[model samples]
Target chain A: MKEPGLEQPGIAVEVAVPVRRTPLDEISRVKMLACQAALGAVIALAWQAVSGRLVDDYFISNPLAIGRRLVAWIGDGTIFVHLWATLYATIVGFVIGSLAGVVLGVWLGVSRFAARLTNPYLLALNALPKVALAPLFVLWFGIGIESKIALAAVLVTFLVFLNTFAGVREVDRDLIDCARLMKASRAQVLSKIVIPSAASWVFAGLKTAVPYALIGVVLGEMIAANRGLGYLVQFSGAQFDTAGVFAVLAVIAVVAMLLNWLVEIWQERMERWRIVSR
Target chain B: MIELKNVSKRFRKGDEVVEAVGGIELGIRRREIVAVIGPSGCGKSTLLNMIAGLYPPSGGRVIYNGKVIDDVNTSVAYMTQKDNLLPWRTVRDNVALPLEIAGLRRAEREERADRVLEHVGLTGFEKRYSSELSGGMRKRACLARMLLQGAESLLLDEPFAALDAQLKLVMHGLLLRLASEASQTVVLVTHDLMEAVTLADRVVVCTHRPAMIALEQAIDLPRPRDVINVRFTNRFRELYDMIWDCLRLEYHEELI
Candidate 1:
């Protein structure tokens, strides 16, 4: 209750400043957070409504009931065991695949003879549907984590290999000439100049390959695994436990987001100079 | 300290064999600065390259310090028109590169690199990358690297052509000062007539295409040359006129 000419000392000014938000930054941040919360709430509400309206509990359980079930699973240590199994397979497969891919890619890119000789073989292998070969992998290595890991590694390798090969090939010729003029020895030129020049491309490839690495692990598990999140999804779906299947999917989405976030952080650290200069 | 005896270079383009330089004989004495001036495509760079041991002549031998030159000679430093600085290395590291490649200890190479950097007025730029530098600064960095090589002779292939007029003059002065102090023999190839007159004790003019020595004029002008003082001098104009007269004929022939 203040006159128009004489405003309240604290309340009016405080409200006015916030309403103005002239910097645009604070306003944008607030708006973004609001949007995120709104979207999350809408999704949750929609899921709750759909589950509530379902005629059969076996087909679609309530979102609240699924949340409770997930909590119970976590408490009983089943979630931890499943997550560990997936993580172990993924890490081992990713490391082996990425290392082999980079080595082969670099060698092929540097030597024309090697590239020419191996191009047809590589293309044939890359073109073949890897998922269709899961049965063969299971047959060859037996139906253990080993077969799944091997399958995952094979799936991840081609993506990394192609990216790295293109990256190495795309290194600037001018930089190479400069190194030659400096009288740099073959090893020095390769390690010091060529590798660093191709670094940005290699990192770009790695970023694109991160999601593929996770997908590879999941695909391998789905084909045949007794303990992974993918196995849980398959088992739940067969039993018509729709809530349990959704819970497994939700865990996978979270893991994927976390892995992608870690990749972005690594990329930022590697390309700090490029970002700062830009 | 360089002797090119009847050096000729030819390039085969499709079915045509074009001679770039024809039987050019030149002797560059120890600590002498020689500038080769000619019209475009007159094979001035080809001659310099032969002297630097970067290219082999179709006929004739290039002798430096009484040794027949074959591949890139360790006793010679050649600076191309392009700066050619490695973007990855800091300025100090780039300057010390030749020494490192020659198997010198890191400590000794760093000391030599520091001395050359100071000599080239780049004392505070040791840690700066080549990508962060301006055109003139990059040229200076290249010059510093050449200085660090401790070569007996320097071959400059239009090293200052990329610079503006003002920067070019400043660089010309810097080169003159450096050449005097180092007492290193230098053979420079350029199309700029005035640059040749200003920096060189002797200038060699060549004819166009299948180039041959048209004239060799000795500049008797006094040392520690002031560009301002020399620019107005009658001797400078006379030398420029002499080189231009020879180059004009070659230019007309090239047009035909």
Candidate 2:
């Protein structure tokens, strides 16, 4: 019996070489962060210096006054109720729409006849502006969370649907043939190959839909709702309270940042297995 | 045994009707290694695809074990030049794919996948995704996946085209060794003349578009060939010159 050498060429040389010897990349990252902080500080100071000087503070509220209003909102604890209401609508809509979209996308993606028959109609429906339909949704579902959820779900469903359809279509034919040769059934192929292949596309669409979902919620609230960030903004604007408007805007900004941060973490975890580093 | 009975294939794109393979009649006995050499886009893969039942021949049928194949042939396993491992799956999971299809339990499939990975010298790479591995490692993982299927017939399309010289020789040795264990019938399509002579029992040179069997040459070299040194032998050189003569002659006519 002959013994195998297993002597791989050049791979050993590659392993011997260090990945990144210098700290230049790390230093550059720190420099970028410091630059952003400095920019924010300058803007804040400039706003404070000019408060009630060139323009009346009533028209353009100062950062400090907005902060004070935010502190006051926190003290009364009513802010939590509004925040929860908005959050509840967004979550319910996102879940229902994303689930329905992926399921239908996969079904239509697999069937050429079904995809062809309904593609144009789906596109036409997606093309319709959500704002134009907001009033109808309110009238149909009433001025409650149901209307808000409907608005958000409609906005989210299409993005996920299109992405998933393309993803399923983009799956390599050779891979499917390879599996078929292995004697995999149709159900097995769909479950094990097609669905897993479409996952990244679904995730991408979900990420893009986040801002739009929030938009749908805020739009519904501004049109007829009793609570939410959008309603708060509309109420303050009506009363000519600029500081109150900025405070509500700040809360919305914070919530958006938190959602985006969570998505960033999720995206990192989902795509960590990617081999694009080389 | 697998036999192609005057098989032919044609593809249509708008007004363009292209004939890929024309009257290809061939036979591959069980456990025989038949190397097919052809020019680029010469329907070598098309012929293999027909035999695998992925593409229906326009004219004739393919016979496997004296039975005509009209649908996908599960008795065969195929490997193409491109590695098609699922990007989302780890190496172990990819290797265990066929087992999953066979409805093997998780622990059993994992155990089987690990053993095969060990055979392919990919033990530490079980957890790594296909995107993380080097080209050679990815190829090995693909081979491991094929190995787990336990299919008796294989249709290989330029399977080792991406490998370096030394690695190709090692893989060729491993392939021959593993092939003989299960009496696997391998129909390999490669551009390398030396590879054909060294690894295959018989070599078939295919003509340019509308491919037909231009020349069929048998390699009478003894078993267990040393892939690195076989090209030095007079018989190997003679076989190489003969096949190259046919290829060069056909290519010369294509210049017109």
Candidate 3:
């Protein structure tokens, strides 16, 4: 009775009506891009004008000050070190967590008895704020990159696990039956049918987990680490350097966007069949 | 040969027990194409499911090739209303799935899949995903996959019901040609009277719910009959009207 939220894993015939583009369409697309750029510029100009005049520089950093701070960090290469540290933890944690989640999800998905038995415990863990586990992770792994990775991994595991579990459960019974009728062995059915069927669902989880991995790494760094973007933000805030904090935040935003783009590329590469070009 | 001896099936929906099929006796000989026609929700599909060993009959037995089918009937290639072709795999890979399951090498699987795909008129579409193909093409791909299984028996549960009239006729011709060449026994379940008359050697009509045999008529059409033009023929019309008459009675009983 559980309908798949994702598209069905079999032949999904979708009509891709090609839209004819006229000069007006091109003009409109250019206009839209221009408007977006104008909006961003307006916001930046307004912020720059308001700082020190409308609000104290200490309270709200000016756009120019934040830009200068970013340039200074880049020139000294200190930004790269913090950036690499955060990136390392995020990537390592994402891989480990995603693997664990997929393994656990598939295991529970295949066996109803195990899913039912561990349902309460799993629910309890998911409900608890994973950030609260940062202190414990720090104690166990020491206030190093391992702690950041552990926190990031913990946050991502729950997210990917839930999506993967639902994906596996939602696989069409008819598809499985089709394989069985073909005399497919149990291992073949799992490998060839079940896993591929749940792939889109797993990718959906991975996409969302990108930002969450950053969040976990940042929070871990803020709580205890001497390195990473989170520590930079924390250190700048303590020193009352509002521009430095803003500069570090901007870098984090860029990193998050970069990670998300990478995941999107990975999904598109693997599931090119789902894409309709337009 | 597939035989159903007083086969019956019941499904429990929460607290209510729904008898899907009841005391149906049918025999399908080797290389024979039999079509089971009935009103919608009359458990025509349940009969095929039982024969495929997807569901054990609530009563009686389903015998296939001198053995009672207790588990999934690996000897039969089953195709349902939905194509059920894997979306991720290209048409060739989907058709070659059974051979891959049988542990054939990649080279052999692809070569055999190409031959079968060509047989189903889908040679040029081997590398395309199912989603990229049209409905009729996807059905052809599905049929190709089923044919590649090399099973002696084919259980088709309204496989061409979703296609247009023209497509249906084309599919009918393709199925007839392929089934006859392979000498595969086909049990086609459908409510389409014309399709039943056009393809089946024998048409078994079942009544409303708790499906039981109402009429069993044989089509004595000659070998290598044209599926499309045969519909316009006098004998085809006679057979169609005869089967429709039996189906009309089932519909009338339901209204009453």
The candidate scoring highest on DockQ is: 3
User: What overall lDDT goes with each candidate model?
Assistant: 0.80, 0.87, 0.91
lDDT of 3 by residue, A1-278 (tens): 33345447785546555667876656777798998899999999999999999998888999999999999999999999999999999999999999999999988999999999999999999999999999999999999999999999999999999999999999999999999999989899999999999999999999999899999999999999999999999999999999999999999999999999999999999987788422
Q: What's the residue-level lDDT of A183 in candidate 2? A: 99
Clashes by residue pair, model 1: none
lDDT of 2 by residue, A214-275 (tens): 88988898999899888888889999999999888888888877777777788777766653
After superposition, candidate 1 runs with Cα above 4 Å error: A1-30, A52-66, A132-149, B1-32, B40-76, B89-96, B99-129, B151-153, B164-170, B177-183, B206-213, B220-237, B251-256
DockQ of 2: 0.43
- Across B16-77, the per-residue lDDT of candidate 1 in tens digits comes to 99999999899989999899988877788788777766668999989989889887665678
TM-score of each: 0.78, 0.87, 0.87
Interface RMSD of each: 3.4, 1.8, 1.6
Give the TM-score of candidate 3 (chain A): 0.89
Tell me the lDDT of model 3 at B210: 95
Give a tens-digit lDDT track for model 2, residues B1-256. 9999999999997999999999999998999999999887889999889889987899988999898988889999888778989988899999999999999999999999999899878999899988888898898899889988899898888888878888788889888888898889999998888888999999999998889999999999888888877889998889899899998876766677
lDDT, residue B58, candidate 1 = 95
By summed lDDT, the worst window of 10 consecutive residues in model 2 chain B runs over B247-256
Clashing pairs in 3: none
**Top model number, lDDT:** 3
- Candidates 1 and 2: which is better by DockQ? 2
